[model samples]
Target: MLPPVWEVVGAGQSLYEQGPVAPGTSTQVIADVPAGSYVALASCGNADSTAMWASDYPGIEEILALFPLTSFAIEQGATVITVPAETPAVPVQQSPSFGSSQSE
Candidate 1:
């Protein structure tokens, strides 16, 4: 399973990023970004700026399991934006049976 990643994006550009951090673990990310409105997002895979709006990816399950995001702005000085400590629930896909169409 791919680990989660943290990203701060604005105007279709990535301002700051942290991770592919291990699952069930946390880390600190500090970056001096310009003052602007940004959106913080976390995902259980390596979905970067390039694949921001991608509908389909290799591991759609990981992409689909995303954390809650909040938009914020930094007027000046230091700013601290936090990604909530929550685990994304990855959906399990059941394989189809070609042998029989009837339920047992």
Candidate 2:
């Protein structure tokens, strides 16, 4: 069996102010994950800029006897994955500043 596909999703500041999407990003990955138990990490990158970051959500033990286990290892051990520098989700939030509204 193959590992379940995981989709990484989040919202954050854009590296470039004139990009199409702002404060939002997502990605997907497919791996041959085992059925008994395993761990996976999600990586994120700036939509506009090339800078990259990662995060890990562990304890994702899937109990399916039919699945197959493939030897896999992450580059880095378990740790709080780094995400694009953006406004804090809780506690505080920040937005772009505008001098004045443009009249049409």
Candidate 3:
């Protein structure tokens, strides 16, 4: 059986790693994240093994069936997003007149 492990990968590197969830239970891990894009992945087997299984088995139904029987693949998560830089807020102020005020 493959060890259950959690990993956070960013910038093509493994940022954090944790786990080996106690046999038949779940677990939670806290990781310090820096400013960057990252993908969190958790698996019960070796690297890419879960993905391979998913491909070979195919379909959610089949995957569900296989999971309870084999418990090979626990979960797969991936996402990447880009946020546009925000424009700084500029205080609006009325322009001062070049000419001096005339007496009424």
Give the number of the best model, judged by TM-score.
Answer: 3
Candidate 3 regions off by >4 Å?
1-12, 46-104
Query: Which pairs of residues have clashing backbones in candidate 1?
Result: none
60-91 per-residue lDDT for model 2 (tens digits): 22311122432223355333223434535676
How does model 3 score by TM-score? 0.30
Candidate lDDT scores, in order, read 0.41, 0.34, 0.41
- Model 1's C-alpha root-mean-square deviation from the true structure amounts to 19.2
- Judged by TM-score relative to the true structure, which candidate is superior, 1 or 3? 3
User: How far is each candidate from the true structure, as Cα RMSD in Å?
Assistant: 19.2, 15.8, 13.3
Model 1 TM-score, 2 decimals: 0.29
Segments in model 1 whose C-alpha atoms lie over 4 Å from true places? 1-12, 46-104
User: lDDT tens string, model 1, 1-104?
Assistant: 22122232224555545456666768657566555444444433344533233223234334334534322222222233444445468997777775677997
Which residue pairs show backbone clashes in model 3?
none
Whole-model alpha-carbon lDDT for candidate 1: 0.41
lDDT of 1 at 96: 77
